[model samples]
Target: MTAGEDISVRRKKLRYRAWHRGTKEMDLILGPYADAHTEALDEAGLDRLEALVNEEDPPLLKWVMGQEEPPENIDRGFLAEVIADHSARLAR
Candidate 1:
C-alpha cells in the first residue's frame, strides 16, 4: 500500500491477494479467512496480515498448517488467532 492509502482500499487489496495466492491450498486457506476478518482489522493488524500474505508459499504453508513455526519476526499472536479461526471453521 502507498503512503496515506485508504484503509478500505488496503483491505480490498489484501483480500484480493489473500484469495488469489498462486496455489489452491493457500487460496482456500486465506480467502475465507480474509473474508471473515479483514474488515475488522486495525492498521497494525493489517500490517501483520500484509506481512503474512507477502511470505512465500512453502514456509507460509508450513506455518499455517502447524507443521512448522513462523520465524521470530512474524507475529505469532496474530497468526495464532488466524489458525484458531481456520480451525474453528474446519470444525463446523
Candidate 2:
C-alpha cells in the first residue's frame, strides 16, 4: 500500500464521520470504501494530489468538484478531485 492510501484511510474517520451517519461508528471509520481507496490509489496518484494541494490552485479544485463548467486545470487524479469528492461527501 502507498503512503497516500494509508493517510487517506487514517484520516477517513475524521474527514468523513457524517458520510456514514446511520452506520456503526467503527464500520464507517473502517469501511470497505476506505480499504478500496487505499488499494486503488497508487503512489503517483497521491503525488499528483499532493502537488495540486501544495500549489493551492483553486481552479483545479473547482474543476474537480464539477462545481464550475470547466477550467484549465482539468486532469485525471489531482488532489482537487480527491478533496472535492471528500467535500461533497462531507456536505451531504
lDDT tens digits by residue: candidate 1, 1-92: 66556898999999999999999988888888899999999999899899889988889889988899899998898778878888898999
- In candidate 1, which residue ranges exceed 4 Å CA deviation? 1-5
User: What TM-score does model 2 achieve against the real structure?
Assistant: 0.32
Report lDDT (Cα) of residue 63, candidate 1.
Answer: 95
Q: Kindly provide the TM-score of model 1 when superposed on the true structure, using C-alpha atoms.
A: 0.89
C-alpha positional error of residue 17 in candidate 1 after TM-score superposition, expressed in Å: 0.3
Candidate 2 achieves a global lDDT of 0.45
Q: Estimate candidate 1's RMSD in Å.
A: 2.6
| Worst-scoring 10-residue span by lDDT in model 2 | 25-34
lDDT tens digits, residue span 43-65, model 2 = 56544433433333344435544
Per-candidate clash tally:
0, 1
